[model samples]
Target: MSTFQERYAASVMNTFGPPKLVLVKGEGAHVWDVDGNEYVDLLGGIAVNALGHGHPALVEAVSAQLQTLGHVSNFFTTPQQVELAEKLLELIGADAGGGKVFFTNSGTEANEAAFKLTRRTGRTHVVVAEQSFHGRTMGALALTSKEAYRAPFEPLPGDVTFVPFGDVDALAAAVTDRTAAILLEPIQGEAGVNVLPDGFLATARAIADEHGALLWLDEVQSGMGRTGEWFAHLPSGVTPDVVTVAKGLGGGFPIGACIALGPAGELLQPGNHGTTFGGNPVACAAALAVIRTIEEQDLLEHVSVLGQKLRDGLVADPRVTEVRGEGLLIGLDLAEERSAEVAAAALKSGFIINNATPQRIRLAPPLVLTDDDAKAFLAAWPAILDEAF
Candidate 1:
């Protein structure tokens, strides 16, 4: 093993298994390992590196903020922190009616804050969708439905129910007046980019309203222009009471937000929850840079156009049975259960992909990925599939 790999194994926890490569440098959508091998990064740090690696805008923003003032603690807020909060509210369309934001260091912390906020509504039960992945923390884990992740962590917080995803009847039956919130992800990223059925989000919104419960959409993996929109649930025209976002928010910096709208915004009072490094100046500055770059570069339009092209090209091969998801967050099913083999083959051929399941391949490349890079991958895809299959 390489020196770095051996050192990593000795020092780091094994929660994520072994490191795939000892990466040394990156630019745009490509990365180079210590051995000097170049490869296109299709996963984009699991959808967190929105601007890709070492983008000038992100680097400069973080550097400038750190040089000025870094962490001020939650007792006092910095201008960057307030500006980012306002920008998030503006993007979420909550500025008009006014909203509140609680910052965290990651998606899991954001969800944890929102989870606690739901308890203030005097309802303990929460209705969540099956196959949903909120986070690994105890509070967030209670909302996740995967058996394997929850089995070992028994005695989790109670009063949580899981309904089949996209099943309107099941959702309607599961929610009641006693429910505190209805949490769902418009695009189920961990479950192989499973998009919600048409009108499913609208139905969820209605159910929450009828039962007087909050509608919380966890947009951690699909927000921040990942689905060609600010948030994936925007197109549904269903305004959620609470939204949790992280992943691509900071373009690589650690930042997350739990935004509550209207009356739901007042649920978490002073001293309800707090975090030390959640909305530090540097993190907020990094997020602001990501948002500005996306707007200036018009990456949303680019993502929409290129995503369609990549999806069309990927399905051309007969081995690909189906393709799902939006923008750069794409997932495909193979004719056989060889996704792991396919991903390994892709890496060997100078590409990086994710095996979301035994038969599912997920691609969440950087939004800044160029047309030439995509074309190169398309050209090499057939051979990669052949070697794997």
Candidate 2:
């Protein structure tokens, strides 16, 4: 092992196993390791590096904002904070004019804030989906359905139920008038990039409306142009009561937000929630740069076009059983459970991917990933699989 890897193992916790590489530099869709080897970063920090690494806009924004006003207590708000909230609300939807935003340092905190806000509705029950991933925090973990993740952290905040994903009937049956909210991911990221069944979100919106329960969508992994849209649910024409976004929101700057729409916006009053660095100027500035870059460079359209190309090229391989998801967020199933081997092979061949499941490989490349980079990966797809399988 390299010295950095050895040091990391000795210093860092084993929650994520061990380090993959001691990356030292990055530019756009590429990165270099400590060994001076280069790679195409297909994971994009698990869909967070919207603007990619060392983006001039992101660097400049963070630098300028830090120089201007690094941080202040929530007692005083900064222009970047308010501007970011407004911009996020606008991107989610125009009807979000009355939407309220609560910023946090990460996706978990965003979900935690939303979880607490649900309790303010005077209801205790929350309906969630099976195989969903919210966060590792206690409140978010309770909302998540994985037994492995929840078992170790027992006695989590109670009154949360999970139903089979894509099964509207099970979801409706699980929800009731006592339900304070129904939390869901527009696209299940950690569960192998599983997209919800057709009209499943519409069904969720209907169910929430039937019981007067708040509908919350966790866009932590799929938002911020990852799915070729601002928010995945926007295409369905279903407006959620609460939307939690992180990951790519700051383009790797570490910021998140829990946005509440309509009357749900008034659920969390002042003093009910607090965060010291939730909307720090530097983070907000970085987020603004990402948003501006996406718009100015038209990365959304690029993601849509390039995603189709990649998906088509990938499925052309007979070894691929099926491909799921949209835009840069893609997952492919193999004919056999060789995902780990495939990931290893990809790394050896100067590419980065994720083994989201035993038989599944996921890719969430940077939105700024160039056409040539994507095309090169596709051209190498057959060789990579052949070498792996």
User: How many clashes in candidate 1?
Assistant: 0
Distance from true position, residue 254, model 1, in Å?
A: 0.3
Candidate 1 regions with alpha-carbon error over 4 angstroms:
95-97
lDDT for residue 123 in candidate 1, whole number 0-100:
90
Q: What is the C-alpha local distance difference test score of each model?
A: 0.95, 0.93
Q: Best lDDT goes to which candidate?
A: 1
lDDT for 295 in candidate 2 is 97
Model 2: ten consecutive residues of lowest lDDT = 92-101
The number of clashing residue pairs in each candidate reads 0, 0
Residue pairs in collision within model 1: none
